[model samples]
Target: MNKDVRASVKVGGQGQWSDHEKWLIEQGQQRIKTLMPEVYKTICRYAEKDSNVWRIVRLGLVGRPDQFWACEAGHVAGAPFTQFKRAVEVSRLIARFGCAHVCMIAGHGDLGGT
Candidate 1:
């Protein structure tokens, strides 16, 4: 996280964070199950495809996304439980499988959508 946010996290008494620090980190990630409520669909689709355990998602910017997926999901990382091969993959899953819990505010996509 940035220096300012780190500085803002109020430390609990006696060097104990009491979970606030960890919670701040999780919230910064911005991925939650509510945004991708495809549990039933995923279960039903699993039998037909058997790719649930082998869901291949190709996120860019370095590391092998498909390789460390289990650990990543355990921590609830990028795009939550899904991965994006391209731009449309983001919206497609969000549309069909998504249940939606977005907060746009008075702005556009984060960081100008890069």
Candidate 2:
């Protein structure tokens, strides 16, 4: 998906930052505040103060248009569970087998792929 919207600026680590780091953090916070509310809202919905995990999956350390994923902490209980690919497979399976097979398919988890 398009990461033109992001929660990176608000990626935890606040209050304990140094002056210079705080400035940068504020800039990121500003970016989120001033530039992208849709992204920010998504972040708010998926991210939490002490729960949830938000990781930016980029090609390298930094750049643009990276993939951002949200893990429902309660769902996996601390394990990061991304349904990006799994969701796709479920879609395909349901197309063929119908919704009744969802439990059967989901029970297989990664569908033998990782």
Candidate 3:
């Protein structure tokens, strides 16, 4: 629930949200609503029924995952502590290189696909 552990970081050394950034937040919120309505509703509850109240900040020093969501306000007693991470698959690697290569690198198995 702590800020550092949550990977929350200031944008451009300023904790302010620009118009474009706000637009991106709105788009992300909408995507969550469409993909996972239940979770989106829960986040809205944490934001006090206003999705716009939720702040979208950048996370630092992480790879693979494109985004990470965490609620500091929900970390309090009797509240829900939830976290979500979004990641995208590499189509080029999956198609051309194949899972065998990825699996070996990921410690799943060797090139034989065992």
- Candidate with best lDDT: 2
Residue-by-residue lDDT tens digits, candidate 1, 23-97: 543443233233333432342343254432212211210122322121122233323322323336545754686
Which residue pairs clash in candidate 1? Answer: none
Best to worst by TM-score, what's the order? 2, 3, 1
Stretches off by above 4 angstroms in model 1 are: 1-37, 51-85, 88-114
Q: Report how far off residue 45 is in candidate 2 (Å).
A: 0.6
**Model 3 per-residue lDDT tens digits across residues 1-114:** 122222333433455444554444445444454554444455445456332223321221121122233222221111111221111224344556544211011111122111
lDDT of 2: 0.34
Model 3 poorest ten-residue lDDT run:
101-110
Q: Model 2 segments beyond 4 Å from truth?
A: 1-15, 48-114
Query: What TM-score would candidate 1 get against the native?
Result: 0.21
Question: Against the true structure, what is every candidate's RMSD?
Answer: 14.7, 12.2, 14.7
TM-score winner between 1 and 3, please give it.
Answer: 3
Clashing pairs in 2: none
